[model samples]
Target: MDLLRSLPLGLYLEQPVTWLHRLDPRVKMAWLMSILVTPILASPEWRFFLVLLLLVLTLSARVPLRVWRQQMGWLLLLSGLVLLLTMVMPDGLVVAQQPRLPSPAEISQLTEPFETLPPLPQPTGYQYVIYDRWPITITQRSLELGIRISTLLFTLIYGTNLFLLTTAPEEITAALEDVMAPLRWFKLPVTEIALTVTLALRFIPLVLEEVQNLVRSVQTRAINWKKLGFRGSAQVWLQVVERLLENLLMRAEQIAAAMAVRGFTSPDEHKVEWHRFVLRAWDWFALGLLAVFWWARLVWGGEA
Candidate 1:
Protein backbone atom coordinates (compact mmCIF):
# COMPACT_ATOMS: atom_id res chain seq x y z
CA MET A 1 0.00 0.00 0.00
CA ASP A 2 3.02 2.29 0.02
CA LEU A 3 2.19 2.89 -3.61
CA LEU A 4 -1.32 3.89 -2.54
CA ARG A 5 -0.03 5.99 0.33
CA SER A 6 0.71 9.59 -0.52
CA LEU A 7 4.29 10.08 0.40
CA PRO A 8 5.26 13.29 2.23
CA LEU A 9 6.69 13.94 -1.23
CA GLY A 10 4.87 17.13 -2.21
CA LEU A 11 5.92 18.84 1.00
CA TYR A 12 9.53 18.44 -0.07
CA LEU A 13 8.71 19.73 -3.56
CA GLU A 14 7.71 23.08 -2.08
CA GLN A 15 11.45 23.67 -1.74
CA PRO A 16 12.53 27.26 -1.21
CA VAL A 17 13.89 28.59 -4.47
CA THR A 18 17.40 29.89 -4.81
CA TRP A 19 19.23 30.51 -8.12
CA LEU A 20 17.60 27.54 -9.84
CA HIS A 21 13.98 28.66 -9.27
CA ARG A 22 14.73 32.14 -10.57
CA LEU A 23 15.46 30.79 -14.08
CA ASP A 24 12.46 31.02 -16.41
CA PRO A 25 10.25 27.94 -15.91
CA ARG A 26 10.48 27.27 -19.63
CA VAL A 27 14.26 27.21 -19.40
CA LYS A 28 14.13 24.90 -16.36
CA MET A 29 11.77 22.48 -18.10
CA ALA A 30 14.08 22.41 -21.13
CA TRP A 31 16.99 21.74 -18.81
CA LEU A 32 15.09 18.94 -17.13
CA MET A 33 14.15 17.32 -20.45
CA SER A 34 17.78 17.29 -21.55
CA ILE A 35 18.91 16.02 -18.18
CA LEU A 36 16.39 13.18 -18.28
CA VAL A 37 17.16 12.02 -21.83
CA THR A 38 20.88 12.56 -21.44
CA PRO A 39 21.09 9.78 -18.88
CA ILE A 40 19.13 7.41 -21.07
CA LEU A 41 21.59 8.14 -23.84
CA ALA A 42 24.52 7.91 -21.47
CA SER A 43 26.08 4.48 -21.01
CA PRO A 44 24.47 2.04 -18.58
CA GLU A 45 27.50 2.23 -16.29
CA TRP A 46 27.53 6.01 -16.35
CA ARG A 47 25.19 6.27 -13.35
CA PHE A 48 27.98 8.16 -11.63
CA PHE A 49 27.46 10.89 -14.20
CA LEU A 50 23.82 11.23 -13.18
CA VAL A 51 24.82 11.14 -9.52
CA LEU A 52 27.17 14.07 -10.04
CA LEU A 53 24.41 15.96 -11.85
CA LEU A 54 22.04 15.29 -8.94
CA LEU A 55 24.59 16.45 -6.38
CA VAL A 56 25.26 19.70 -8.26
CA LEU A 57 21.52 20.49 -8.47
CA THR A 58 21.02 19.62 -4.80
CA LEU A 59 23.79 21.97 -3.76
CA SER A 60 22.55 24.68 -6.11
CA ALA A 61 19.09 24.57 -4.52
CA ARG A 62 20.56 24.01 -1.03
CA VAL A 63 18.28 20.95 -0.82
CA PRO A 64 18.55 18.84 2.29
CA LEU A 65 20.47 15.57 2.13
CA ARG A 66 18.13 14.15 4.78
CA VAL A 67 15.15 14.50 2.45
CA TRP A 68 17.03 12.69 -0.33
CA ARG A 69 17.93 9.97 2.15
CA GLN A 70 14.24 9.48 2.95
CA GLN A 71 13.55 8.60 -0.70
CA MET A 72 15.97 5.62 -0.54
CA GLY A 73 13.04 3.27 -0.13
CA TRP A 74 11.62 4.22 -3.54
CA LEU A 75 15.08 3.96 -5.10
CA LEU A 76 15.54 0.47 -3.70
CA LEU A 77 12.10 -0.51 -4.90
CA LEU A 78 13.04 0.49 -8.44
CA SER A 79 16.37 -1.32 -8.35
CA GLY A 80 14.85 -4.46 -6.81
CA LEU A 81 12.28 -4.53 -9.58
CA VAL A 82 15.12 -4.40 -12.11
CA LEU A 83 17.01 -7.22 -10.39
CA LEU A 84 13.88 -9.39 -10.25
CA LEU A 85 13.23 -8.95 -13.96
CA THR A 86 16.83 -9.88 -14.80
CA MET A 87 16.65 -13.10 -12.75
CA VAL A 88 13.33 -14.41 -14.12
CA MET A 89 13.41 -13.61 -17.81
CA PRO A 90 11.89 -16.47 -19.89
CA ASP A 91 13.39 -15.99 -23.34
CA GLY A 92 17.10 -16.11 -22.46
CA LEU A 93 18.75 -19.52 -22.14
CA VAL A 94 17.65 -20.93 -18.81
CA VAL A 95 20.26 -21.73 -16.17
CA ALA A 96 19.51 -23.94 -13.20
CA GLN A 97 21.10 -25.29 -10.00
CA GLN A 98 20.35 -28.93 -10.92
CA PRO A 99 21.33 -29.94 -14.44
CA ARG A 100 18.47 -31.42 -16.50
CA LEU A 101 20.86 -33.95 -18.13
CA PRO A 102 21.38 -37.36 -16.47
CA SER A 103 24.58 -37.73 -14.49
CA PRO A 104 27.05 -40.59 -15.38
CA ALA A 105 25.99 -42.50 -12.26
CA GLU A 106 22.34 -42.30 -13.31
CA ILE A 107 23.07 -43.65 -16.85
CA SER A 108 22.66 -47.22 -15.65
CA GLN A 109 18.89 -46.63 -15.45
CA LEU A 110 18.62 -46.12 -19.22
CA THR A 111 15.87 -48.05 -21.05
CA GLU A 112 18.35 -49.60 -23.54
CA PRO A 113 20.86 -51.83 -21.73
CA PHE A 114 23.81 -50.66 -23.89
CA GLU A 115 22.77 -47.03 -23.89
CA THR A 116 25.40 -44.63 -22.54
CA LEU A 117 24.79 -41.09 -21.22
CA PRO A 118 27.20 -38.24 -21.27
CA PRO A 119 28.17 -36.80 -17.87
CA LEU A 120 25.98 -33.95 -16.59
CA PRO A 121 27.94 -30.93 -15.44
CA GLN A 122 26.84 -27.70 -13.83
CA PRO A 123 27.60 -24.79 -16.15
CA THR A 124 29.52 -21.77 -14.95
CA GLY A 125 28.56 -19.62 -17.94
CA TYR A 126 27.62 -20.98 -21.32
CA GLN A 127 24.80 -18.71 -22.47
CA TYR A 128 24.08 -19.72 -26.06
CA VAL A 129 21.47 -17.58 -27.79
CA ILE A 130 19.04 -20.16 -29.25
CA TYR A 131 18.06 -19.03 -32.71
CA ASP A 132 14.34 -18.39 -33.20
CA ARG A 133 13.50 -18.40 -36.93
CA TRP A 134 10.19 -16.74 -36.07
CA PRO A 135 9.85 -13.00 -35.91
CA ILE A 136 12.26 -11.54 -33.37
CA THR A 137 10.40 -9.92 -30.52
CA ILE A 138 11.69 -6.97 -28.49
CA THR A 139 9.81 -8.27 -25.46
CA GLN A 140 12.45 -10.95 -25.11
CA ARG A 141 14.67 -8.07 -24.18
CA SER A 142 12.09 -6.69 -21.74
CA LEU A 143 13.88 -7.59 -18.51
CA GLU A 144 17.38 -6.47 -19.41
CA LEU A 145 15.85 -3.62 -21.38
CA GLY A 146 13.55 -2.92 -18.45
CA ILE A 147 16.56 -2.67 -16.16
CA ARG A 148 18.12 -0.13 -18.51
CA ILE A 149 14.88 1.86 -18.67
CA SER A 150 14.49 1.78 -14.86
CA THR A 151 17.81 3.60 -14.56
CA LEU A 152 16.45 6.57 -16.51
CA LEU A 153 13.07 6.30 -14.77
CA PHE A 154 14.67 6.57 -11.33
CA THR A 155 16.94 9.37 -12.50
CA LEU A 156 14.03 11.45 -13.73
CA ILE A 157 11.93 10.62 -10.66
CA TYR A 158 14.69 11.85 -8.40
CA GLY A 159 15.40 14.87 -10.60
CA THR A 160 11.70 15.66 -10.50
CA ASN A 161 11.86 15.12 -6.74
CA LEU A 162 14.54 17.80 -6.59
CA PHE A 163 12.46 20.16 -8.74
CA LEU A 164 9.35 19.56 -6.67
CA LEU A 165 11.29 19.80 -3.45
CA THR A 166 12.88 23.11 -4.35
CA THR A 167 9.94 24.80 -6.07
CA ALA A 168 6.38 25.66 -5.02
CA PRO A 169 3.35 24.21 -6.84
CA GLU A 170 2.22 27.78 -7.72
CA GLU A 171 5.65 28.50 -9.12
CA ILE A 172 5.53 25.26 -11.09
CA THR A 173 2.08 26.14 -12.41
CA ALA A 174 3.34 29.52 -13.47
CA ALA A 175 6.28 27.77 -15.11
CA LEU A 176 3.94 25.44 -16.97
CA GLU A 177 1.89 28.38 -18.27
CA ASP A 178 5.00 30.18 -19.41
CA VAL A 179 6.25 27.08 -21.19
CA MET A 180 2.89 26.49 -22.88
CA ALA A 181 2.46 30.06 -24.16
CA PRO A 182 4.16 29.34 -27.48
CA LEU A 183 1.26 27.10 -28.49
CA ARG A 184 -1.16 30.06 -28.36
CA TRP A 185 -0.67 30.70 -32.09
CA PHE A 186 -2.24 27.28 -32.73
CA LYS A 187 -5.23 28.38 -30.67
CA LEU A 188 -4.20 25.98 -27.93
CA PRO A 189 -6.12 26.62 -24.73
CA VAL A 190 -2.90 27.34 -22.80
CA THR A 191 -5.03 28.07 -19.76
CA GLU A 192 -6.52 24.58 -19.83
CA ILE A 193 -3.04 23.13 -20.22
CA ALA A 194 -1.85 25.04 -17.17
CA LEU A 195 -4.94 23.97 -15.17
CA THR A 196 -4.29 20.30 -15.89
CA VAL A 197 -0.78 20.68 -14.56
CA THR A 198 -1.87 22.61 -11.43
CA LEU A 199 -4.62 20.12 -10.63
CA ALA A 200 -2.21 17.18 -11.02
CA LEU A 201 0.35 18.98 -8.87
CA ARG A 202 -2.25 19.65 -6.15
CA PHE A 203 -3.91 16.23 -6.26
CA ILE A 204 -0.74 14.08 -6.20
CA PRO A 205 0.17 15.19 -2.70
CA LEU A 206 -3.42 15.22 -1.48
CA VAL A 207 -4.00 11.66 -2.66
CA LEU A 208 -0.68 10.52 -1.16
CA GLU A 209 -1.59 11.93 2.25
CA GLU A 210 -5.10 10.45 2.10
CA VAL A 211 -3.68 7.03 1.27
CA GLN A 212 -1.12 7.12 4.06
CA ASN A 213 -3.83 8.03 6.57
CA LEU A 214 -6.05 5.15 5.40
CA VAL A 215 -3.13 2.70 5.52
CA ARG A 216 -2.31 3.75 9.06
CA SER A 217 -5.98 3.31 10.00
CA VAL A 218 -5.99 -0.15 8.46
CA GLN A 219 -2.83 -1.08 10.35
CA THR A 220 -4.44 -0.01 13.60
CA ARG A 221 -7.31 -2.42 12.83
CA ALA A 222 -4.75 -5.32 12.91
CA ILE A 223 -4.33 -6.10 9.21
CA ASN A 224 -0.70 -6.92 8.68
CA TRP A 225 0.32 -5.31 5.41
CA LYS A 226 3.60 -7.16 4.96
CA LYS A 227 2.14 -10.65 5.30
CA LEU A 228 -0.70 -10.20 2.86
CA GLY A 229 -0.60 -12.30 -0.34
CA PHE A 230 -1.13 -10.68 -3.73
CA ARG A 231 -4.87 -11.32 -3.88
CA GLY A 232 -5.34 -10.35 -0.25
CA SER A 233 -3.38 -7.15 -0.85
CA ALA A 234 -5.43 -6.44 -3.97
CA GLN A 235 -8.69 -6.69 -2.02
CA VAL A 236 -7.41 -4.29 0.60
CA TRP A 237 -6.28 -1.95 -2.19
CA LEU A 238 -9.73 -2.08 -3.82
CA GLN A 239 -11.36 -0.98 -0.60
CA VAL A 240 -8.79 1.76 -0.18
CA VAL A 241 -9.43 2.84 -3.75
CA GLU A 242 -13.17 2.98 -3.11
CA ARG A 243 -12.56 5.20 -0.12
CA LEU A 244 -10.18 7.32 -2.19
CA LEU A 245 -12.85 7.84 -4.84
CA GLU A 246 -15.28 9.00 -2.18
CA ASN A 247 -12.69 11.33 -0.69
CA LEU A 248 -11.71 12.72 -4.09
CA LEU A 249 -15.38 13.36 -4.95
CA MET A 250 -15.93 15.21 -1.72
CA ARG A 251 -12.77 17.24 -2.19
CA ALA A 252 -13.72 18.06 -5.76
CA GLU A 253 -17.12 19.28 -4.64
CA GLN A 254 -15.50 21.42 -1.99
CA ILE A 255 -13.08 22.90 -4.54
CA ALA A 256 -15.94 23.61 -6.96
CA ALA A 257 -17.91 25.31 -4.19
CA ALA A 258 -14.89 27.24 -3.02
CA MET A 259 -14.04 28.39 -6.54
CA ALA A 260 -17.61 29.47 -7.04
CA VAL A 261 -17.43 31.53 -3.82
CA ARG A 262 -14.14 33.14 -4.77
CA GLY A 263 -13.30 34.36 -8.26
CA PHE A 264 -10.70 31.57 -8.89
CA THR A 265 -11.76 31.95 -12.53
CA SER A 266 -9.17 30.09 -14.65
CA PRO A 267 -5.83 28.35 -14.48
CA ASP A 268 -4.17 31.23 -16.32
CA GLU A 269 -6.67 33.87 -15.23
CA HIS A 270 -3.79 36.01 -13.98
CA LYS A 271 -0.63 36.43 -16.03
CA VAL A 272 2.80 36.48 -14.55
CA GLU A 273 5.05 39.45 -15.29
CA TRP A 274 7.85 38.10 -17.50
CA HIS A 275 10.20 40.73 -16.11
CA ARG A 276 9.60 39.51 -12.57
CA PHE A 277 10.29 35.87 -13.60
CA VAL A 278 13.35 36.79 -15.68
CA LEU A 279 16.82 35.70 -14.74
CA ARG A 280 18.48 38.04 -12.26
CA ALA A 281 22.25 38.52 -12.45
CA TRP A 282 22.69 35.30 -10.49
CA ASP A 283 20.15 33.57 -12.70
CA TRP A 284 22.03 34.87 -15.72
CA PHE A 285 25.20 33.44 -14.23
CA ALA A 286 23.44 30.08 -13.69
CA LEU A 287 22.23 30.17 -17.29
CA GLY A 288 25.79 30.73 -18.42
CA LEU A 289 26.91 27.81 -16.30
CA LEU A 290 24.19 25.59 -17.81
CA ALA A 291 25.33 26.62 -21.30
CA VAL A 292 28.89 25.78 -20.36
CA PHE A 293 27.72 22.43 -18.98
CA TRP A 294 26.04 21.62 -22.30
CA TRP A 295 29.01 22.94 -24.28
CA ALA A 296 31.46 20.76 -22.43
CA ARG A 297 29.23 17.74 -22.91
CA LEU A 298 28.68 18.41 -26.61
CA VAL A 299 32.21 19.57 -27.43
CA TRP A 300 35.66 18.32 -26.43
CA GLY A 301 34.74 16.97 -22.99
CA GLY A 302 32.43 14.43 -24.71
CA GLU A 303 30.91 13.44 -21.37
CA ALA A 304 27.29 14.34 -20.72
Candidate 2:
Protein backbone atom coordinates (compact mmCIF):
# COMPACT_ATOMS: atom_id res chain seq x y z
CA MET A 1 0.00 0.00 0.00
CA ASP A 2 2.82 2.35 0.81
CA LEU A 3 4.47 1.58 -2.50
CA LEU A 4 1.17 2.11 -4.27
CA ARG A 5 0.77 5.50 -2.60
CA SER A 6 4.36 6.44 -3.37
CA LEU A 7 4.31 5.37 -7.04
CA PRO A 8 5.13 9.03 -8.00
CA LEU A 9 3.79 8.75 -11.52
CA GLY A 10 0.93 11.23 -11.35
CA LEU A 11 1.60 12.74 -7.94
CA TYR A 12 3.34 16.14 -7.71
CA LEU A 13 6.48 16.78 -5.66
CA GLU A 14 7.09 20.30 -4.34
CA GLN A 15 10.23 19.97 -2.28
CA PRO A 16 13.70 21.05 -3.40
CA VAL A 17 12.58 23.40 -6.11
CA THR A 18 14.67 22.99 -9.24
CA TRP A 19 15.08 25.26 -12.24
CA LEU A 20 12.40 23.32 -14.08
CA HIS A 21 9.95 24.01 -11.29
CA ARG A 22 10.86 27.67 -11.26
CA LEU A 23 10.35 28.08 -15.01
CA ASP A 24 7.10 29.65 -16.12
CA PRO A 25 4.30 27.11 -16.41
CA ARG A 26 3.31 28.44 -19.82
CA VAL A 27 6.84 27.82 -21.03
CA LYS A 28 6.68 24.29 -19.68
CA MET A 29 3.38 23.80 -21.51
CA ALA A 30 4.96 24.91 -24.76
CA TRP A 31 7.86 22.57 -24.19
CA LEU A 32 5.39 19.74 -23.60
CA MET A 33 3.51 20.55 -26.80
CA SER A 34 6.76 20.52 -28.75
CA ILE A 35 7.74 17.18 -27.33
CA LEU A 36 4.34 15.78 -28.30
CA VAL A 37 4.07 17.26 -31.81
CA THR A 38 7.66 16.86 -32.98
CA PRO A 39 7.45 13.08 -32.90
CA ILE A 40 4.48 12.95 -35.24
CA LEU A 41 6.63 13.56 -38.34
CA ALA A 42 10.00 12.41 -37.01
CA SER A 43 11.66 9.31 -38.40
CA PRO A 44 12.62 6.36 -36.24
CA GLU A 45 16.07 7.79 -35.71
CA TRP A 46 14.67 11.14 -34.61
CA ARG A 47 12.17 9.43 -32.37
CA PHE A 48 15.04 7.62 -30.68
CA PHE A 49 16.74 10.98 -30.25
CA LEU A 50 13.57 12.35 -28.71
CA VAL A 51 13.57 9.52 -26.20
CA LEU A 52 17.17 10.26 -25.29
CA LEU A 53 16.32 13.91 -25.04
CA LEU A 54 13.61 13.06 -22.54
CA LEU A 55 16.23 11.30 -20.41
CA VAL A 56 18.52 14.32 -20.70
CA LEU A 57 15.76 16.71 -19.65
CA THR A 58 14.92 14.55 -16.68
CA LEU A 59 18.53 14.55 -15.57
CA SER A 60 18.86 18.29 -16.07
CA ALA A 61 15.71 18.92 -14.07
CA ARG A 62 17.51 17.32 -11.11
CA VAL A 63 14.49 15.38 -9.92
CA PRO A 64 15.26 12.54 -7.56
CA LEU A 65 16.86 9.70 -9.50
CA ARG A 66 14.80 7.19 -7.57
CA VAL A 67 11.54 8.78 -8.79
CA TRP A 68 12.51 8.16 -12.39
CA ARG A 69 14.05 4.77 -11.67
CA GLN A 70 10.79 3.43 -10.30
CA GLN A 71 8.91 4.58 -13.38
CA MET A 72 11.63 3.53 -15.83
CA GLY A 73 11.37 -0.11 -14.84
CA TRP A 74 7.69 -0.20 -15.67
CA LEU A 75 8.11 1.87 -18.84
CA LEU A 76 10.90 -0.38 -20.15
CA LEU A 77 8.95 -3.51 -19.31
CA LEU A 78 5.93 -2.24 -21.27
CA SER A 79 8.08 -1.15 -24.20
CA GLY A 80 9.84 -4.51 -24.32
CA LEU A 81 6.54 -6.36 -24.23
CA VAL A 82 5.16 -4.22 -27.06
CA LEU A 83 8.31 -4.74 -29.13
CA LEU A 84 8.09 -8.49 -28.58
CA LEU A 85 4.50 -8.51 -29.76
CA THR A 86 5.31 -6.44 -32.83
CA MET A 87 8.23 -8.71 -33.74
CA VAL A 88 6.20 -11.92 -33.37
CA MET A 89 3.12 -10.75 -35.24
CA PRO A 90 3.18 -11.89 -38.88
CA ASP A 91 3.20 -9.08 -41.42
CA GLY A 92 0.82 -9.18 -44.37
CA LEU A 93 1.46 -11.87 -46.92
CA VAL A 94 4.15 -10.92 -49.42
CA VAL A 95 3.37 -11.94 -52.97
CA ALA A 96 6.25 -13.64 -54.70
CA GLN A 97 7.42 -11.86 -57.89
CA GLN A 98 9.01 -15.03 -59.34
CA PRO A 99 7.61 -16.23 -62.68
CA ARG A 100 5.55 -19.43 -62.73
CA LEU A 101 7.23 -22.72 -63.58
CA PRO A 102 7.71 -23.20 -67.32
CA SER A 103 4.81 -24.96 -69.07
CA PRO A 104 5.16 -28.68 -69.86
CA ALA A 105 4.70 -27.97 -73.61
CA GLU A 106 7.59 -25.50 -73.55
CA ILE A 107 9.72 -28.02 -71.66
CA SER A 108 8.94 -30.65 -74.30
CA GLN A 109 9.80 -28.25 -77.12
CA LEU A 110 13.12 -27.45 -75.49
CA THR A 111 13.86 -31.12 -74.91
CA GLU A 112 12.85 -32.28 -78.44
CA PRO A 113 16.53 -33.27 -78.99
CA PHE A 114 16.06 -35.88 -76.21
CA GLU A 115 18.63 -34.17 -74.00
CA THR A 116 18.06 -32.71 -70.57
CA LEU A 117 16.99 -29.11 -70.95
CA PRO A 118 19.00 -26.58 -69.00
CA PRO A 119 17.49 -25.83 -65.66
CA LEU A 120 14.85 -23.12 -66.06
CA PRO A 121 15.82 -19.72 -64.84
CA GLN A 122 15.62 -19.66 -61.09
CA PRO A 123 12.88 -17.60 -59.48
CA THR A 124 13.74 -13.93 -59.56
CA GLY A 125 12.35 -13.06 -56.14
CA TYR A 126 12.24 -14.60 -52.70
CA GLN A 127 11.00 -18.19 -52.61
CA TYR A 128 9.92 -19.97 -49.44
CA VAL A 129 10.10 -23.74 -49.44
CA ILE A 130 6.93 -25.61 -48.48
CA TYR A 131 8.73 -27.28 -45.57
CA ASP A 132 10.23 -24.03 -44.31
CA ARG A 133 7.51 -22.93 -41.93
CA TRP A 134 8.94 -20.11 -39.94
CA PRO A 135 6.18 -18.72 -37.78
CA ILE A 136 7.46 -15.14 -37.69
CA THR A 137 10.03 -13.40 -39.87
CA ILE A 138 10.63 -9.76 -39.03
CA THR A 139 11.39 -7.34 -41.81
CA GLN A 140 13.34 -4.11 -41.56
CA ARG A 141 10.23 -2.06 -42.15
CA SER A 142 8.38 -3.75 -39.33
CA LEU A 143 11.35 -3.32 -36.99
CA GLU A 144 11.59 0.36 -37.84
CA LEU A 145 7.88 0.89 -37.32
CA GLY A 146 8.02 -0.90 -33.97
CA ILE A 147 10.94 1.14 -32.80
CA ARG A 148 9.22 4.38 -33.75
CA ILE A 149 6.07 3.39 -31.90
CA SER A 150 7.99 2.31 -28.79
CA THR A 151 9.93 5.54 -28.71
CA LEU A 152 6.72 7.50 -29.03
CA LEU A 153 5.17 5.65 -26.11
CA PHE A 154 8.23 6.16 -23.95
CA THR A 155 8.53 9.82 -24.82
CA LEU A 156 4.89 10.58 -24.04
CA ILE A 157 4.99 8.79 -20.69
CA TYR A 158 8.27 10.27 -19.57
CA GLY A 159 7.53 13.76 -20.82
CA THR A 160 4.14 13.94 -19.15
CA ASN A 161 5.64 12.52 -15.97
CA LEU A 162 8.29 15.18 -16.07
CA PHE A 163 5.74 17.94 -16.44
CA LEU A 164 3.48 16.62 -13.72
CA LEU A 165 6.42 15.97 -11.42
CA THR A 166 7.75 19.51 -11.65
CA THR A 167 4.49 21.39 -11.94
CA ALA A 168 1.86 22.07 -9.31
CA PRO A 169 -1.88 21.73 -9.87
CA GLU A 170 -2.48 25.46 -9.50
CA GLU A 171 0.34 26.24 -11.86
CA ILE A 172 -1.08 23.87 -14.46
CA THR A 173 -4.51 25.47 -14.27
CA ALA A 174 -3.06 28.97 -14.41
CA ALA A 175 -0.91 28.05 -17.38
CA LEU A 176 -3.86 26.54 -19.17
CA GLU A 177 -5.91 29.63 -18.55
CA ASP A 178 -3.18 31.83 -19.95
CA VAL A 179 -2.75 29.66 -23.00
CA MET A 180 -6.45 29.43 -23.69
CA ALA A 181 -7.26 33.06 -22.93
CA PRO A 182 -7.63 33.69 -26.65
CA LEU A 183 -10.60 31.38 -26.72
CA ARG A 184 -12.52 33.86 -24.60
CA TRP A 185 -12.76 36.19 -27.58
CA PHE A 186 -14.69 33.45 -29.36
CA LYS A 187 -17.14 33.16 -26.45
CA LEU A 188 -15.66 30.00 -25.02
CA PRO A 189 -15.91 29.19 -21.31
CA VAL A 190 -12.18 29.08 -20.70
CA THR A 191 -12.39 29.76 -17.00
CA GLU A 192 -14.90 26.96 -16.50
CA ILE A 193 -12.76 24.59 -18.45
CA ALA A 194 -9.69 25.44 -16.41
CA LEU A 195 -11.66 25.05 -13.22
CA THR A 196 -12.87 21.65 -14.29
CA VAL A 197 -9.33 20.51 -14.99
CA THR A 198 -8.08 21.96 -11.72
CA LEU A 199 -10.79 20.22 -9.74
CA ALA A 200 -10.02 16.93 -11.44
CA LEU A 201 -6.32 17.10 -10.65
CA ARG A 202 -7.02 18.27 -7.12
CA PHE A 203 -9.41 15.38 -6.45
CA ILE A 204 -7.09 12.64 -7.65
CA PRO A 205 -5.02 12.50 -4.47
CA LEU A 206 -8.12 12.77 -2.34
CA VAL A 207 -9.73 9.90 -4.17
CA LEU A 208 -6.62 7.80 -3.80
CA GLU A 209 -6.45 8.59 -0.10
CA GLU A 210 -10.06 7.57 0.31
CA VAL A 211 -9.42 4.33 -1.50
CA GLN A 212 -6.44 3.56 0.71
CA ASN A 213 -8.44 4.33 3.82
CA LEU A 214 -11.25 2.08 2.65
CA VAL A 215 -8.85 -0.77 1.98
CA ARG A 216 -7.26 -0.39 5.39
CA SER A 217 -10.64 -0.28 7.09
CA VAL A 218 -11.69 -3.46 5.35
CA GLN A 219 -8.45 -5.17 6.31
CA THR A 220 -8.74 -4.05 9.91
CA ARG A 221 -12.14 -5.67 10.09
CA ALA A 222 -10.54 -8.95 9.08
CA ILE A 223 -12.71 -9.67 6.12
CA ASN A 224 -11.92 -13.16 4.87
CA TRP A 225 -11.82 -12.64 1.12
CA LYS A 226 -10.76 -16.23 0.48
CA LYS A 227 -13.48 -17.84 2.52
CA LEU A 228 -16.11 -15.48 1.19
CA GLY A 229 -16.05 -17.35 -2.15
CA PHE A 230 -16.24 -15.67 -5.56
CA ARG A 231 -19.80 -14.39 -5.45
CA GLY A 232 -19.46 -13.11 -1.91
CA SER A 233 -16.16 -11.49 -2.76
CA ALA A 234 -17.72 -9.77 -5.74
CA GLN A 235 -20.57 -8.51 -3.58
CA VAL A 236 -18.11 -7.19 -1.01
CA TRP A 237 -16.13 -5.39 -3.66
CA LEU A 238 -19.27 -3.86 -5.13
CA GLN A 239 -20.31 -2.65 -1.71
CA VAL A 240 -16.92 -1.18 -1.06
CA VAL A 241 -16.98 0.63 -4.38
CA GLU A 242 -20.48 1.94 -3.68
CA ARG A 243 -19.35 3.24 -0.33
CA LEU A 244 -16.35 4.90 -1.86
CA LEU A 245 -18.44 6.63 -4.45
CA GLU A 246 -20.92 7.76 -1.85
CA ASN A 247 -18.16 9.26 0.22
CA LEU A 248 -16.68 11.01 -2.78
CA LEU A 249 -20.03 12.45 -3.78
CA MET A 250 -20.63 13.68 -0.26
CA ARG A 251 -17.27 15.35 -0.19
CA ALA A 252 -17.94 16.94 -3.55
CA GLU A 253 -21.28 18.25 -2.38
CA GLN A 254 -19.63 19.68 0.70
CA ILE A 255 -17.04 21.42 -1.44
CA ALA A 256 -19.72 22.75 -3.76
CA ALA A 257 -21.72 24.06 -0.83
CA ALA A 258 -18.64 25.69 0.59
CA MET A 259 -17.90 27.29 -2.76
CA ALA A 260 -21.48 28.55 -3.07
CA VAL A 261 -21.21 30.13 0.33
CA ARG A 262 -18.16 31.97 -0.96
CA GLY A 263 -20.02 33.28 -4.07
CA PHE A 264 -18.57 30.90 -6.67
CA THR A 265 -21.78 30.39 -8.58
CA SER A 266 -20.33 30.64 -12.06
CA PRO A 267 -17.04 31.29 -13.76
CA ASP A 268 -18.23 34.63 -15.11
CA GLU A 269 -19.38 35.82 -11.72
CA HIS A 270 -16.72 34.24 -9.53
CA LYS A 271 -13.36 34.35 -11.22
CA VAL A 272 -10.44 32.38 -9.87
CA GLU A 273 -7.61 34.70 -8.92
CA TRP A 274 -4.55 33.64 -10.84
CA HIS A 275 -1.06 35.05 -10.60
CA ARG A 276 -0.48 36.94 -13.83
CA PHE A 277 1.98 34.91 -15.90
CA VAL A 278 4.82 37.00 -17.35
CA LEU A 279 7.32 35.50 -19.75
CA ARG A 280 10.81 35.70 -18.33
CA ALA A 281 14.13 35.41 -20.16
CA TRP A 282 14.18 31.66 -19.63
CA ASP A 283 10.72 31.41 -21.14
CA TRP A 284 12.05 32.87 -24.40
CA PHE A 285 14.90 30.41 -24.24
CA ALA A 286 12.38 27.61 -23.89
CA LEU A 287 10.53 28.89 -26.95
CA GLY A 288 13.84 28.98 -28.78
CA LEU A 289 14.33 25.34 -27.88
CA LEU A 290 10.94 24.52 -29.41
CA ALA A 291 11.85 26.47 -32.53
CA VAL A 292 15.05 24.48 -32.88
CA PHE A 293 13.21 21.20 -32.51
CA TRP A 294 10.71 22.07 -35.19
CA TRP A 295 13.43 23.37 -37.49
CA ALA A 296 15.32 20.10 -37.12
CA ARG A 297 12.16 18.13 -37.82
CA LEU A 298 11.51 20.12 -40.99
CA VAL A 299 15.07 19.70 -42.20
CA TRP A 300 15.27 15.98 -41.43
CA GLY A 301 11.95 15.06 -43.04
CA GLY A 302 11.11 12.36 -40.50
CA GLU A 303 10.62 9.34 -42.75
CA ALA A 304 10.99 5.66 -42.11
The sequence of per-residue lDDT tens digits that candidate 1 reaches over residues 7-49 is: 5454544345466656666566767776776664454445456
Supply the global lDDT for candidate 1: 0.66
TM-score of each: 0.63, 0.86
Clashing pairs in 1: 6-208, 12-165, 13-164, 13-165, 15-165
lDDT by candidate, in order shown: 0.66, 0.81
Best by TM-score: 2
TM-score of 2: 0.86
